[model samples]
Target chain A: MAAFALGWLALWELAARAGWISRLFFPPPTTILLTLGRMLVTGNLAPALALTLYRLALGVAIGAGSGALLGWLMGSSRSVRLALDPIVTALHPLPKLAIFPIFLVLLGIGEASKVALVALTAFFPMVINTLAGVQQIDTTHWEAAANYGARGRALLQRIILPGSLPLVLVGLRLAVNGALMVTIAVEMLSAREGLGALIWLAWQTLRTEELYAVLLVIGVLGLASNSLLELTSQRLLPWKGET
Target chain B: MQITYRIAKYLKVVLAVLLLAACTPIGEPATPTPAPVLVRVGVLPFMSNAILKIADAEGFFVEQGLTVELVPFRSSNDFVPLLLQGELDVAAPALTAGFFNAIARGGNVKIALPLTAFTPQDCPVVVVLARKSDVEAGKYASPAQWKGATIGISLAGAQGLPGYVVDLFLRQAGLTAQDVTLTALDPAVQGEALRSQQVDLLYAAEPWITRLLAGDDVVVLSRAEDVAPDLTSSFMVYGPSLLAEPEVGRRFATAYLNAVRQYHEGKTPRNVELVAEYAGLETELVQQVCWSDIPLDGAVNVDSIMLYQEWLHDLGLLDRLLSADEFLATGFVEVPE
Candidate 1:
């Protein structure tokens, strides 16, 4: 896979360098790497990366916590599920980007609005996935827990949570990606410092090398974040491997 | 079950409202249109777009039997492609290399009107800002001290208006591109960056420039007009569809010129109020900043545009240089005798 990717990069570099493709629009990978080095040495990359991560972390935490809480409640109680299903179904289909202006207006065009947009984007998938996870658990598990005198929070902690852990992890993994995407998008739209804003600024100035470097950074961050989540899931759910 | 039904009913209503909102135009005609021609105008929420906003707000477009749909863009660079693709009937973009490159690539958009001309008095539209601490510390105090100073520009290289203006200042100061460090920073964050001491200087635009100047930690170093007086910065471009329909072009030019005339009446409370409402700035700030000179007849200086194009071509950013006659649509706005 690495070889194939490198081969593709080499082809792109040749195309750009040979003038088959305009270097003004898409600089070669070597040029992008050199630009990346300059950005790092100039102390531009660290602050932007740090700010983007900070926003993503807080946003996903807030969004996932609330989504999981609500999803679990809706899954456990028929009444709650019935009431929320209609609203969730209607909202989940709406594009999160479209409501960004409203968030900007309500939260002010600061860190708050960008964080809120990421939280909103992450919220939907987390809720939907966790809800599906909870619903997929057998009624037998619930009955067994109830027969053991495990009711309410006790039953939830012992059976419902553990049983649904696999699916919830999946949801969390998905939500992280969603949160990162929203974070970058909002930053691009209006931010002083972030990877997305860096990409936009580079594009506007016709700095194709800088643009590609930033894009590569974003891709690496996404891959690294997802891999971290997967590793955590593996450690926590050791029994899942056996199953 | 009853609660669930009620919630579902409410959800249905909300969904209906959202769908209806998605279908509605931003600037719908007040009177019912028997058959109104829909004109999608691509615009940024900037003071330079005061004429377009006025035309919409004052029913100038509606009076011409046009349903002007204002499509807001974050940057003019984002909409030039859309204009070429026929998604936007008209666009007012700052004369940047991106727009010229688009035109060089056979983009069908034509310069229909000149938007803003800079003068010494009205040059606050684009200005250089520096950290107050730097100024007080005697850093970047003179044009000769510009060497090694980190300058935050709003876009890549010297292709953007801010970059061009900054370059003009540097040249006048006997400095070259090697004398300074140019970082691509967004205007939205330039103020905070200045305050935090991340950048020593910033080339920024109004609203941001106005807001930065108001900050205790920032000071205006120079305005664009100081370096390049009477430099035409923005132009109104008509999409191929609009250019093909001469009647639509004529009506739009007439409506736009009407607003320009009103704006030229100069800083009346009513004009300031309209500009403030559109640019999302306070009325006081809008009044305080210098307003660029917009032609009443909506005619652009073709010679100036050609000079700008030649400069970009020489810079190698433009693949092809377009002739003024090929890129500009004349006769829409009558030239004054």
Candidate 2:
């Protein structure tokens, strides 16, 4: 896969060098890499990356924590499910960006608004996935837990949580990815820092090479995060076998 | 199966109708009429772009043998890319670091005409507003008081006209950019930000200036005109499509300047009506907001543009400092001696 990626980049570089593509719009990979290196050396990339990651971490934690708790409740109690399902169904399809202005108004145009937007974007996938995770657990497992005298917290800790672990991981992965995306988007709209702001600045200043470099950084960050999540899931769920 | 069958039957009927419509032909005229050259002009619903609307409404484009298509855009970011890509024949956006940067990077777009400027007679097209509460509390009373205060602008990087104006305001008081934090806020929410005390000062343009001034929330700190008199704010840019055909560009300019003459005729009833109709503002609001000056002969201030380029370059927002000749496509319209 690495070789294939290198070959693809080589073709792109060749095309740009050969003038098949407009260099002003699509700089060669080498140019992008060099630009990225310059940004890093010049101490521009690190802070932006760090801020974006920080926002993503905080947003995903808040969103996923609340979403999992509510999802578990919804799955455990039919009354909860019926009440929230309509609200969730109505809201899940609405774009998070549509409500960003409201967040800015409520939270003010600061870090709070950006973080809130990211959290909202991360919330839906986590809730939906976690709800499915809890519902899909076998009823026999619950009965078995009860037979073993497991109740309330004990039942939750030993049976429900462990049984629902796999889908919960899936939910977490989705939330993290969504959180990152929203972080970049909100930052682009109204921020002076982060990869999104860098991208916006590059765009505003017509620094196409710099824009491409920031985009590459974002892509790598996404890939690295997903890999880390996958490795973590494997370690947490060894019994699931090769997942 | 029944649903699929019904869908297929409906599709067949639709296709039959389409085929019938396609086969039907209208006879051509005996004399072949020359097609008017189509120019796709991108515009934002701002007072600055009143000339494009005036030109269209007054049939100036028709007189020039051009078919003008006014494409509305939300922001320069939206239309700049399109203009670069040749999707838009012309665009009139504020003179920004981005536009200069594009030209430096070999984007086949050139400043065709001066769109708007700050003149003595006109109200300030852009202004710096301080929070009313802050002003009442004896804060931001003068430029010296702006030290360590947060100023909200529509764009960051200090690369645009507002940034230059702010810098001018700062320098007059021996203050610099480091003394105050310049935060970028959307123009739509700038009033709210100031009202909520998110930022101590706002660099705003009309009709936002008019609307914000309506309430007692913000007090005018400085007018851009007072700071930088005769400063050019925006320009009409010609993309590759228009640039490739000099005659078409010249014709467009001719019509545009004709409209500029009408615009300079002041707020006539017809002019106000056209501006209101084009800008999607009420006639009263149209009359209320301050308008920028467009040169009667459409002559650009070359020195002013060069000064802006130097400022951006000095600020490190622009990598290449462009010469006036490199970006300005002159001789499209007559410049006064």
Candidate 3:
């Protein structure tokens, strides 16, 4: 993987130096790295990265928690599912960014709106995944636990939750990624600081090298975050064969 | 049959070779003429873009021997980066802190032409707006009473032009930034914010101002010109590549100046019609909308730009003040004799 990436970068560097492409329009990897180093020394990237991660954490926590609870309820009950399925289907296809203006009016243009946007984006994926996870379980799991005199919380704790754990973990992972994507997007639209703001500002000021550096940081952070989630999910769901 | 086919193919090849030789020069190498310079201009769909649009519409660019492409941008915020990336050869975004910062950091972009200036006339460059309920309630009865009021701006802080309006207003009213709240709100929702009482006041430019005034509940408290007079708000900028080719830059300037002259020939019916068409407004609204004051010959005021930069530094928005020579592209604009 490293070799493949480096080979392409090397070719780009040669082409840039040979003047096949203008440096102003597309800076080489070396220039982007140098600019990234400068940004690090200036303390520009630290706070932005921290803020973006913070927003992602808060959003994912709120969204996944509420969505899992609601999805489990709907999955367990016929009337609840019938009532919410329509609303879910209608909202699922709608882009979250389009409703940002409404969010701004309701929540005000501050941390609240940004967090809400991220939460809202993550919410849909979590709801859909959790619902599917619960419904996918065989009725035998529920009946088996109830036969042992398990009732209410006991039945839920012993059967429904454990049976759905693997697929629910998948939902949580997807929701976290969704939350991060929404967080970055909202930050770009109206933030004073964040990786998204850094990217937008760099683009606005025509700092091509800085823009590419910030993009690289975001990409690495996203990969690391998704991998961390995968590791945690594996430990929690050992029967899933380290997936 | 086979022999005849082979003979015909060989004859065709021989004839093609002869034609090529006939087209070739016998002696000395041929000198190639340079290709015509193509300029990609970034413009906002606003009345302020009248000069550029007119130059394009009237064939002035073609007359000057330059091919110009005008790309419409939604905001000035998107203009600078594209210009710097060489995707755009020219742009005329407002003189915000971002532009100054780019220049201070040694970005190869320079102020090329003066696009518009806030004049002494009763032009509507910017205005302070208040809700009718707030006005009637005597909330901001006096300028000093503006304390503790929530003022919505399209962009807040030293980076935005409205921040200067806040500065001038506070200075006039004997207040400071700490005395009130300044929130960055979208101009699209500024009127709604006022009507809903989400914000106490706002600083907005024309069209929005005109649209908001059409409602019974909004009133103009003051004009930006009255507070900060004779200021050049926005101007054209060019990347280094455009400047490196002296003749291309001159031709662009010449064509632009001709349009500016036509714009300033005193808003006749035709001029009003052109403004209306470009700004996407009715002709009557165009007449009511105060046109920005620009120099007839399109010369940027370097001293005013210096003063603006000093103010930006004082506000802590700019790290360092760039000298006039460093900021301005001298000799780009040829003064009309």
Best by TM-score: 2
Fnat scores for every prediction: 0.09, 0.62, 0.16
Error of 2 at B310 (Å): 1.1
Interface RMSD of each: 6.8, 1.9, 3.4
Please provide, for model 2 over A95-194, each residue's C-alpha lDDT reduced to its tens digit, 9 standing for 90 to 100: 8987888888889888888888888878888899889999999989988987899888897888778888899889989998888888988888888889
Model 3 per-residue lDDT tens digits across residues B246-335: 788888998988888888886788788877888788998888777887787667767777876777778655747888877678676766
Per-residue lDDT for B335 in model 1? Answer: 80
TM-score of chain A as modeled in candidate 1? 0.96
lDDT (10s digit) by residue, model 1, range A78-138: 8999999999999987888888766655564457877988887778888888888899999
Question: Chain A structural similarity (TM-score) per candidate?
Answer: 0.96, 0.96, 0.96
Give lDDT per model, in order: 0.80, 0.86, 0.80
DockQ of each: 0.06, 0.37, 0.16
lDDT, model 1, position A122 = 78
**Model 3 chain B poorest 10 in a row by lDDT:** B154-163
lDDT of 1 at A232: 83
Q: Relative to the unseen true structure, what is the C-alpha lDDT of residue A135 in candidate 1, on a scale of 0 to 100?
A: 91
Candidate 1 vs candidate 2, TM-score winner: 2
Q: Provide the DockQ value for model 2.
A: 0.37
